[model samples]
Target: MAQDDTPSAFRLPDPAVVSRTMADVAERGQRIVQDFLKRQSDNASNGGGTGGAGSDPLNLAGAFMEMTTRLMSNPARLMQAQIGFWQDYMTLWQHTARRMMGKETGAVISEDPKDKRFKDDAWRDNEIFDFIKQSYLLSARYFQTAAASAEGLDEKSAQKVDFYTRQFVDALSPTNFALTNPEVLRRTAETGGENLLKGLSNLLGDLERGKGSLQISMVDRSKFSVGENIAVTPGSVVYQNELMQLVQYNPSTEKVLKRPLLILPPWINKFYILDLRPKNSFIRWAVEQGHTVFVCSWVNPDESLAEKGFDDYMQLGPYAALEAIEKATGEKNINAIGYCLGGTLLAATLAHMAAKRDTRIKSATFFTTMVDFEEAGELSVFIDEEQLQALEDKMNKRGFLEGSEMAGTFNMLRANDLIWSFVVNNYLLGQEPFPFDLLYWNSDSTRMPAKMHSFYLRRMYQQNDLIKPGAVDLLGVKLDLRKIKLPTYILSTREDHIAPWQSTYRATQIYGGPIRFVLAASGHIAGVANPPASGKYSHWVSDTAPPTAEAWLEGATELAGSWWPDWHRWVSALDKAQVPARTPGDGALAVIEPAPGSYVKVMASD
Candidate 1:
């Protein structure tokens, strides 16, 4: 008997099950809509009508308008772009038609190998999905090219246009939507529309958590706590102040380097990023390496801390920690390390101490820090006059910048990874985010004091004044980077979006002291938090300093494994006098509390 020449029917979800799921999804969606409307109503009654600071806070419209004017002026160029877009689509259509006819045809366009959005086999093997993928890619390229090619606009405006254009394009990716995404479609079919219902529930939960705004949950927050699973290194809070609490870890070795290590982490996030877990904890590793490690855990500021300024952070933070360290260890000289914003502050404090003839801090190390903000990376797109004024207005009203707002800005830097990935996992695919220590710490953002944040943005980012001698005044002392003469080590990540390695490398030219610059392989957090045991990212080291970052990289030697050992060797070489290990409260500064102190435990929502 001849085989039946009939096409098999597609597997469809049960109508009753789909109906029930659709009803539940509709109910959840309706609640979300109701909550959003109520929020808008409350805002309107409170004299907030989506105007002034509320609308166009980033001044995105102005940049896009300028780009549009520039593009309109060159009609021939615009027409040429339109023609090119159609030509690509035509090629894609031809390729897709051949694919449907069982002909082996090359793709009209392909995604970057790093692009994970189209990693599913169906995106390549299925003709319809392949066409959809290429169409999106082609359009994304067209939009980005147009934005980059905008003429007559200033550098800042051009950057804004390009950056936001990419964000818009990324948002419109087929993978972010349920109907367009093959993975989501497959999951939906397998679950019989249950995934859509769950997705709606997740969407509602996120909306409710954000109080009408969408705050996509990036990790399972229930799985981790600050002082419990993560940040579990044994230590005590030796010193506390309004701005920060200095935690002095109990030494792991019998003897430690005489010069204790004080770490000043950025106040924008908690210090536990360095102490996430024992294996990857920089704090734990440092203590094991025979160094008395002390870290400053910054407070999550509120309206009450509104008056605090950058000067207060410097004096009450690292400076206060310095005096306390002296009383604790009975040592006048010490070594210091700072990460990101903290590193910038450390550089300034070094200058302040230089003028006062205070030589307590013998060595300094900066992790992805930028003293010179001339090329401050994509973050500069948010630092223009209009946006600053708008941001100041918002902060002035609340006495501090909301942690969520700052988090959103940072997320925009790597939207595909930080923002869209969560959107797909938690909303589109109806899957809960994996339990991740780094993302948990990332979600636990800290508010910035209005005065301090304003001073930082205006001085460092907008005006680019930190690099100039006497450009910044702190506690009656002019902060000149040139005056900071301590032996310095600057570690910059090659893929750092927040602090470009080249921008951070400019510090080598400014400081009077001998400098060693090292470039590590991943982005900001992963590169810095890498452990030797993990054997993950590689780093580059060079003894000589070149005028340009590119030249420095050209002569640098690529080495395998983490840069932590290299750093330990360099810091230890500074002053390797050994002393008997001292416990947290063994010295004059008594223990106030346990490690990962109360300050870090305070959530932004709280």
Candidate 2:
């Protein structure tokens, strides 16, 4: 085979960095040797002691013995689990063999239906491929058993072990292997091994780009620009402050709802999630429904904005937007909606308004937002004393948390789907990532201010301060959710990993109002973004607030289609009669530019 010459694909980093790294590594090696010798000498002086039992090499042996003993102690349960695994394995083999022999096997063996790699016909048609799939499945089952068998480990530590083990298992799947992956092999043949060359190129490119780590290209950054491809809802930047840009979308109907709708989207990411595509856009949908909508497009923070804290967000974010909306629309009251972290701020603003006896916001809607941080889910794992301190140190140095750093933490929460899938596709298979709007939005993260990020994580996540009345002070006012008496609409996703449905449901008890909590199907983003056209998922609705989330779920009526229509009807009831439609600049506030605003366009420094 002739070696097909391809141009060198990637540039090497500066040679100065390589030299510095080499010198630093040598210095570190010397330091490590010296430390080890010092430690040994200290141990000898201390009567041949090496810390305690946990640190002793013999204790590691004892730990292994304890593990074996625990396994031995649970012989019956172990035997039962092992037997069940073997039964499943045997069934899979029989089915695979029968299928390969061109015999009809009615029901296929699948441990996890979510695993898509085995769905390919090539895996079933080829005997070797079939065996490989079965083998991996069987191994995965064994790994689950092994993980379950482990005892005496902390919950978080155990979870880490299980998670990494699963990642290892998933990485070893036939789909990732060059020979077993049909698509890679086919492309290799068609391209005369150029696919492999490109794959190597992609790998090198990611390495050079990501520096040392693999930052898999999850989104086609070039495909979607802020105002062009997405966030195209017709609107104008009515007001600009240091923290956010207030966008009042142009009304689509002749008669709009009397009360204006103000959106507070999470600053953790760009605000365009609510306005992704015309069909899927919530802002567009709301406008078509005869409502005056406004959204706060948050400014991506840098070192200059590092001093901006949660208080700044409260004062300049919702409060400032409320004043601007009132000024523009000539409506005394506004219907405010908050998503995720934005929701938290919105709740705080409501409490602040309640304290001041302000009637600017008549009604409120929270989308997959958590007021009670007691059950913030997997995100809490990354927040602790040591972790927070380390994070603070990083923020202190940089003045803001890097968007990539924040995004990396989120990607870790769903590593298999968000991280490894891209790794296999982009680097291993040498494929450009499929255009996904959600992923594109997710990749477009915003930096968090040092003071603001620290305050949010420590006060909300670590201490669970938000749930306690008067515990959190925002803008010189103690935030008490119970003070909020306006009619509230809460939408929590049944499968939300970020804000668990229960924690979101807890918001019902926090506020002093008639709460209409709806449990939407799918995860955090998808549930909220669900459109009526898809007809894919269903949502649960409850008229009366229940004692617990489980209780609410039990009595809840499952409704078909998107929850948007249901919410629209609910909000319409709270709002006044229809009035003449108002354009962005038609009001007192002048329009700066089109919708999606300039604040959202401002990119965080790399």
Best by TM-score, which number? 1
lDDT for position 232 in model 2:
95
What are the per-residue Cα lDDT tens digits for candidate 2 across 1-606?
856445432334346655654565566545555666776687568555534432432123433455557667878877887888888778877876787788877443444778666667766666767677777777787876776686676554454455556666777877877887766665665655545545665665554445444567787787888899888999899998999999988888999999999999999988898999998999999999998999999999889988999999998998888889878988888899999999999998899888889978888999999988886777876665656776776688669998988898888777768877776678666788878889988888789999999999999998989878899988778878899999999999988878899989998888888889999999999999998998968999989897799998989899998999999999999855989999988879998888787788877645
Question: What's the lDDT of the predicted structure labeled candidate 1?
Answer: 0.91
Give the per-residue lDDT of model 1 (tens digit) for 1-606. 855434332345578867776776677667878988997898688776888766888888888999999999998998899999999999889888888899999978889999988899999889999999999999999999888877899999999998889999999999999889988888876766666766777888888788778999999999998888999999999999999999999988999999999999999988999999999999999999999998999999999999999999999998999999988899888899999999989999999999999999999999999999999999999999989998887788789999999999999999999999888888878899999999999999999999999999999999999888888999998877788888999999999999999999999999999898999999999999999999999999999998999999999999999999999999999887999998988889999999989999998999
Q: Give the C-alpha miss distance for residue 60 in model 1, angstroms.
A: 1.8
Clashing pairs in 1: none
| Error at 232, model 2, angstroms | 1.1
